[model samples]
Target chain A: MCIVCGCGHAEAGTGEPEHDHGHKHHHSHGSRLDFGGGPAGVSLPGLDQARILRIETDVLAENDLIAAHNRAYLSEHGILALNLVSSPGSGKTTLLVRTIADLKDRFPIAVIEGDQQTSLDTERICATGVPALQINTGKGCHLDAHMIDHALTTLAPGQGSLLLIENVGNLVCPAGFDLGEAHKVVILSVTEGEDKPLKYPNMFAAADLMILTKTDLLPYLRFDADRCIDYARRVNPKIGILRLSSETGHGLAAWYDWIEARRIPVSQQED
Target chain B: MHEMSLTNGILRILEDQARTRNFSRVRTVWLEIGTLSHVDPEAIRFCFESTSKGTIAEEACLVILEPAGQAWCLDCSQSVTVTRRGDPCPICGGFMLHVTGGEELRITELEVE
Candidate 1:
């Protein structure tokens, strides 16, 4: 397991091998485990005593740095990168499949699919005749910026192309990690509780746009659309909302139009 | 849990600091986690204990400081303290509460030898 994030796959870091923690440092219940109990709190002869360092550093600084690099690279290439976030069973893959099929003629597209242990979504995207890559995070629930950094090399999306990253089907963990995308598009289905916005406020707040998927079933389900929007707005007043059903092809034009409007201008494209 | 990842992040930071500052081990870590950061302090404690093993921070003391959540209510035009998200303005009872603080997940200080 990657010790940095406890994700099943080990991406690169200090490259230290795993160690067994069980040792002869047994202490009483009330006693402290003092590894530097020498005079002046010193453990080594050459080093000084223990001193406090005011680091004031963000815990996720490493990830954020890598994400910033990714943002720079994508910006240099003028790629419209979107990180798609949602829970499992929200029809994210289905929506992607439909979106790709409809927009293939308009733009060059590629996909990077993130899942704990599956290549199924990548296969579905490839079926649409567009290049796609799958990242199996193993036990990792969310995709980090470092992983995205490596995938960018293999995917090598062309300039001005649309890059869609289907993050692991999770709402809570993905919110904290920035994947260097232009926007975080969260997909919520009508089948789930409308109060999801209230329940997972971080995801709702982090998202730039909330796509209500499976809207065709709204007639059968008692999902309150207004209440859901109200809750989402309560969390993020500026978040954009779009409702669409990939099955019936309803409200898809607006979704496409949204993408078109956000596309980077060709004149600003770089090699 | 996301806390596992966060614990690892803390470890990485410690190791990086150790390399630059020529420290061998970490004695204690003081983390400032805000109430609105979506990070659970208890979960972080559990993960830290389990993941810090066999590392420089093994058996190290973790001090968590939870700062109160603060938000600006547009309706009342004043800042108010909130415990969590979706909270209405304490004074005006409106939904225009914009969070301004308590989302910090930072390692403020560390004791190393």
Candidate 2:
């Protein structure tokens, strides 16, 4: 397992042996049996008194530090960075493809695709003739600040450009990690349950915008758009709600307007 | 699922402390996980054991302190206890509750040698 993110890299577990940071040490002692036993089963013995150090450190401090640096870097470059998060099969990539095609002429758009194993999403984004970088996180669930910092170096989006970071298809973990995006846009497909916001409140609460995608399927399916928005509002009253369908181009204009509203004006970009 | 990454975070902290504090082995780790932090204590324990293997914190005792979620009810204008993130304010039954506390994930103290 990679110690940084605990990614097992279950598939194609070859040629990356150096990434595996953990050592497979088979100790006979169990976790339950090792409590306050005076370190009897410790691998390193002959230690003195157990010093109680009052550290009180935040676990995500390192990631947050890197994320701060990324935010500053993006702000200095006048890049409108958006971190797109959603569950699997939410048509996030399709939405990105459509968004890119719609605004590519007006703005220099780039993408950073994150997934556990394949470069498929990156390839799909690159088909739009935009520079895209694929970050295979292996078993890592979400993209962290450090990963985004590294991706920024390679996929260097132009000044005053839009950087769309498509996070891995998981709603939970991505909510916690700040990828230095100006706003987090979370997508909830209408095909899914309406009570998803209640089930995944953290993700809903963390998002600046809650995009209700696949609205074209709403008529065919028994999905309540109002109730879903209400549920999302229950978690985050200030969250902006947008209903769009990438397939039929429904509500795409409003989505485009929303993006344009957040963009820094060309005149201000010089500042 | 994300606990694996969190365990890695803990491991990094332990490694840093070992170098600065001059400790070769970690005996116990006291973690303060809040209810709204979205991290399961059991899953963290399991992941920590696996990720900390061959590290300075291998076989270390993990003492997790889970604090209950607390929120400020906008309707009632009072502080209330909440166990879950989406749960309404217990007193007023209002969903307009702003989270006030219990979202911490920190390593409070460590027993090292």
CA RMSD, predictions in order: 10.7, 11.8
Best by lDDT: 1
Off by over 4 Å in 2: A1-50
Query: How many clashing pairs per prediction, in order?
Result: 0, 0
Q: Docking quality tier of candidate 2?
A: acceptable
RMSD of 1: 10.7
Across A1-271, the per-residue lDDT of candidate 1 in tens digits comes to 2211112223333333332211111111223333224332222234343476657789988999999999999999989999999999999999999999999998899999999997999999999999999999999999999999999999999888999999999989999999899999999999999999999999998999999999999999999999999999888877999999999999999999999999998987875
Runs in model 1 lying further than 4 Å from the true structure: A1-50
- Per-candidate Cα lDDT values, in order, are 0.85, 0.83
Lowest lDDT sum, 10 consecutive residues, model 1 chain A, at A21-30
Residue A87 displacement (Å), model 2: 0.9
Q: Candidate 2 versus the native: TM-score?
A: 0.85
Provide DockQ values for all models, in the order shown: 0.30, 0.29
Which digits, one per residue and each the tens of the lDDT, describe model 2 over residues A1-271? 2111123222332333322212121122223222233332212234343476657788999999999999999988889999999999999999999999999999899999999998999999999999999999998999999999999999889999999999999989999899899999999999899999999989998899999999988879999999999889888877999999999999999999999999888888755
